[model samples]
Target: MSAAAGTGAKRPARRGIVLALALAALVVAVFVGANAHLVYVAVTSQPDCVPHAKEVGIDGAPLRAARSAC
Candidate 1:
């Protein structure tokens, strides 16, 4: 009877440890997924640049700045 009680207590403790580890793994997976999405957006998106018409030189000449594929 004492041995059976000890085994039952150990089973619950083992289950608790397994649950904690699974929760930790889920948190890590979510964190990694969010970071990956952010990286993808940063890589795929383009930056906005000032248009050529908006810029003018001091000598009244139109400044042809480097154009971007906006």
Candidate 2:
């Protein structure tokens, strides 16, 4: 008999590989969806600029920069 016919070992199963690919795709989809939602919210929401403390903090820095003098 030829050497090719002498071996009886079975080929490896692909179920695990398919399952792992599905899980990776699911994670990527969720990540992209979340980022898209965040971008949408940022673009849609526009609150008027509010007042900020004019004095510097103890650290000698503004609490936060005022977008406008409003």
Residue range 35-60, candidate 2, lDDT tens digits: 99999999998888765656568456
Best by TM-score: 1
lDDT of 1 by residue, 1-70 (tens): 9999999999999999999999999999999999999999999987776445535574475665555454
| Residue 52 displacement in candidate 2 (angstroms) | 5.3
TM-scores, all candidates, are: 0.68, 0.54
Candidates' C-alpha lDDT: 0.83, 0.73
The residue ranges of model 2 lying beyond 4 angstroms of the native Cα positions read 1-12, 52-70
Q: How large is the C-alpha RMSD of every model relative to the true structure?
A: 4.1, 6.2
Question: lDDT: which candidate is best?
Answer: 1
Model 1 lDDT, full chain set: 0.83
